[model samples]
Target: MTYISRAAKILSSRVSADVVILGPTVIGEGTIVEPMVVIGHPVRAKLMKALGSDLGIDEYMDSISSGSQIGSNCIIRSGTVIYEDVVLGDNVETGHNVLIREGTRIGSGTRVGSGVIIDGETIIGSNVSIQSMVYIPRGTVIEDGVFLGPNVVITNDKYPPSRRLDGVRIRRGAVIGANSTLIAGIEIGENAVVAAGSVVTKDVPPNKVVMGVPARPVYDVDVFIRKRAEYEGSKAP
Candidate 1:
């Protein structure tokens, strides 16, 4: 009972009833799309140019990509809105009510939790886990094995209505705790840990742990991991 657009190419995918797929999209094998999912929805380029041109926010004009591609073994939950020009690798899972904008590239084994809003032009690598209510702005780059806890807000714009907006870069294996806010143009280095409720305004070095407002270096990441392991072991029955 799937309603696929005549222009779309589905390759042995599973789409639930009430799902709409428009434009030129390609779905790979073993992909499961739940009900109320919108794929390859059309965007009004004229509207963007009309309103954004006056504000110097013309960067969103090229946000739409050429085609939409979902790889094998991907699970797109209900109420998910995925725009055109996005590519997803195998074994990706999305929770309900997720909004994924255009020009996003997601690698294999990525799990996105419910109510997550990922803006356009985002590049996410393999084995990343983004928890619920996380807001990832456009132009963000998340490397492999990054873990983002719930309510983590990653901003892209340095100033409102400015054309010089840039997103944050999160390196491989970094862990961002819940309710952390990351400002634009900052880099979280590999294996770094940002503690909960931290407001990160500057770059974080590799293998370090940062906490507090305008988060500063607290300790080594390796030490924190070791301590966590010890605590978990102590709690074992």
Candidate 2:
């Protein structure tokens, strides 16, 4: 059942009938929201529950929900849930079953693949490509033009179940390979590359290529680029 709030502003002609848009959510022009998508879902429900508020669910949600903003020309696939207070810039696309929590900001032209879970307070820059099954924890910062391959896991807690959470920062144009696990508090420098299945435990210098369980710099970005060019040139048309 579709539920669009009276205070919501939906300028898009492509929103599916089965979607639920609550609060003052804004869906911009030409955006396509697929079936089962829930935009501007209030996150205050958890807080209200914890506080044992006497207010009804709908009433409390309506009172505190600020709603999300989905920019123009974007595509939000099926089963995606964007919580209230999230902002998606123009042309941002998300694959099926993606979860973007509150306080997350996704810049324009970013493409998030299926099963991606972006926890609250994450900042993702423009043109970022996050492939399938990526797990981005809270406070993670991904700069422009970054590529996160399938099943890449970025953590936040340095010590398991600890109070302190430190997010990993992936600088501009960095490439994190498939199945790579980036430990908390590490920084992948600009244009750096983490080879497939690596477990990064520390900072990677700019333009370097790191690999292995405790990933170490093996070569520079120039070498990796040259090798890629050679491989592409060798392929038959």
Candidate 3:
């Protein structure tokens, strides 16, 4: 059961909506956004009204863009700015002050916490958990079962603030901890674990444990050999 407050009802007349509204937001049609939520459009910049009344063409345009794709049974909380051409699957939850940029595709059952800036053209797979203050750079791919801890920053530029080209790919089951940095063009193998506060400059092996600046292998040769042998033995007679 969805409930719309009296305030939301009055605000809905000045705005667009589907079922419920708990706070201020310039929403689109067919969207059932939840309470205390602020969806679409970024509170109109100071320089915007100085130029024109065409809020549609203003810097905060996504606050009122059409053709947005929000699936059923999703909970979009307060102060979330979902940009134009963004597509979200069912059962997705977005917390406060999160900026989901245009051309992004989010799979089902993904829970994104507050203050996350998911850049354009990023593909996030199902069952992913992204904590707060994480910046998923443009054109990146986050596959299934991936977990990103708070303050995790993923970059796509070896040159930073810009890349020679566009796009970076993060494979499946890759768990990046808080304050870790991933360099450009490096493929983090499936099920890899990156330690907190580490800086990665090279490719990480599958199911491996890596840490520290220019993150290297933490396990000894004997440990690697023993683990590999045990794995191999389990598969054999």
Candidate 4:
């Protein structure tokens, strides 16, 4: 049998309570602060400490790393490490132990899954669904409504042993499967679907589906659009 830990239970004890001290911290009022979680933000933490006697903030830097920006109405589940200069929009939800690096702009309603590593200077659009353990390298721009499967690796260097080149751009609504690796400088078109474990090395056309290593077309529109339309019409209400 597994035992679950409650956040409220840890904060109840004076000796057991782990205090955090920060500058410019701006957490919302009536927010539940769990025990043993150290957060740093100088001015805001000091302001909140003066107001509430229930608050205890004196060891933030000793426990958690600094310079992370957490927005309002966000649910950062336990064990998450948000890196510096990462701008998370409102209503973003992150699972445990997620890593969002510096200069990353994740749009509103984006759900960064557990254990995912989003590298620096990347732009993730609104409503994007990234699964666990995905590695989005530097300078990649993932457009809105994209679905990334678990363990997908998006590389930025077209040439191996590269000298800090820019990353690839995945257009809107593209679905990349688990364990897939996308090569740099290629533009994946909108609404395209790449199958699991594929290696992307070229440009993918819009509204198409590809599979296998070096990802070739398997489900082009010419092969199934007419049949699909007939099926849709037959089932119309």
Candidate 5:
């Protein structure tokens, strides 16, 4: 059954009846919320569950949820769970079964593909394209026009289960290839390209192309662009 909190401000006309909107969530105009999408789910719900609180779902959410904001003209696909305190800018789109945790902010025109998991407190800039099955941990920052290919993994903890957390920063117009694993605390410079299946451990300088296990610099972005143009020219019909 779908549940909408009395405090929610729903301005959209395309919300499905099976969607759950809790707390004081705001659904903007022209947005399409697919079936089984849960918005404004409280982050403290887990704590309450752990503590075995007897409070009902509505009562608990009302007490602890700060709510979330879904901007105008957005598309939130099915089975997506957006935690409280998350903000999505206008024209953002998410694929099916995406999980966005609390305190996350996504800018306008960003596309998060299916099965993507974005942990809390991350900032994603405008027009970023994240392909399918990407895992973005907490504290990550993706600048505008960045392209992350399928199955890209971004880590925040240097050591597993450690207290210290450092995010990977992808500068504007960078392209991270498919199946790449970006380690913690690395900065991918603007317009840089990471070749497919690379395990990036260090910061990549601006406009360079890197490949291999440790992801060494292979060439500059100018060379990569020229090669790309040549390849495209060959493929022209």
Candidate 6:
């Protein structure tokens, strides 16, 4: 059993009874929030509005204040913290201790592993698999069926703390290997495979295999996939 705060907006009759919602967050029917999940933690809208008023840009505050929404049948695991204005589609699942920040939109059937931090304003497509300890910065776009291995770092800023930031875009069916680092503004094309421990600095073409520091295209991704399949088959019992 879970405790749902009276301030929470529960549109669903099937939510876990003990979850804590601190804002005007909406949870769709059939969504399951495990014990200790926190949704819509205070965004200080009023204070933000005041600051914006002082700065002569109060309209910015309005875009920042809408509460979060979880779609039907989504399973939010324990110890996950979702900030305000984040929208999640149906059947999305998150592992323990995941932190999803504000203004992000996650499509259906995405599985986010434990210890993942998805920063604000990210757009993630359906059926994406993001493994543990991956850091996705703000403004990133990940298309459908993308696979991100553990400890992948997707950067969004070319210069540290710069006013301008451009996020990396991963196209459909791209596979980013473990411990890979994608610098800001790089595009991983459809079906591209980034080898483990690679640092990608530029755009990777479709169906290509890239490896090493300042990653360079090594071969066709199909060749790598076939070799991988054969190796796995040989190891099978």
Q: Best candidate per lDDT, number? A: 5
Model 2 lDDT per residue over 1-237, tens place = 577777889999999989888789999999999999988877755555635767765556655678899999999999999999999999999999999999999999999999999998999999999999999999999999999999999999989999999999999999999999999999999999999999999999999999999999999999999998999889687
Question: Which digits, one per residue and each the tens of the lDDT, describe model 5 over residues 206-236?
Answer: 9999999999999999999999999988956
Clash pairs (backbone) in predicted model 3: 40-63, 41-63
Better of 2 and 4 by lDDT: 2
Q: What's the residue-level lDDT of 219 in candidate 1?
A: 97
Rate residue 72 of model 5 by lDDT.
Answer: 100
lDDT of 1 by residue, 4-100 (tens): 6666788854777678776668888889999998887545574345463543222222233244888898999998988888888999999999999
RMSD to the hidden true structure, all candidates: 5.6, 2.0, 7.9, 9.1, 1.7, 5.0
Candidates' TM-scores? 0.89, 0.94, 0.70, 0.70, 0.95, 0.87
The predicted structure with the larger TM-score, 2 or 3, is: 2
Error of 6 at 176 (Å): 0.2
Candidates in descending TM-score order? 5, 2, 1, 6, 3, 4
Q: What local distance difference test score does each model get?
A: 0.87, 0.93, 0.68, 0.67, 0.94, 0.86
TM-score of candidate 5 on Cα atoms, chains taken together: 0.95
Runs in model 6 with CA error above 4 Å? 1-7, 11-14, 44-65
Name the weakest run of 10 consecutive residues (lDDT summed) in model 5: 44-53
User: What is candidate 6's lDDT per residue for 51-102, written digit by digit as tens?
Assistant: 5364422223323445588998999999998988899999999999999998
lDDT of 1 at 153: 98
Compare candidates 1 and 2 on lDDT and give the better one: 2
lDDT of 3 by residue, 123-150 (tens): 9998899999999888688888888889
What value does the lDDT take at residue 210 in candidate 4? 82
lDDT accuracy of residue 205 in candidate 2: 97
Candidate 1 local Cα displacement, residue 14, angstroms: 2.1
- TM-score for predicted model 4 compared with the true structure: 0.70
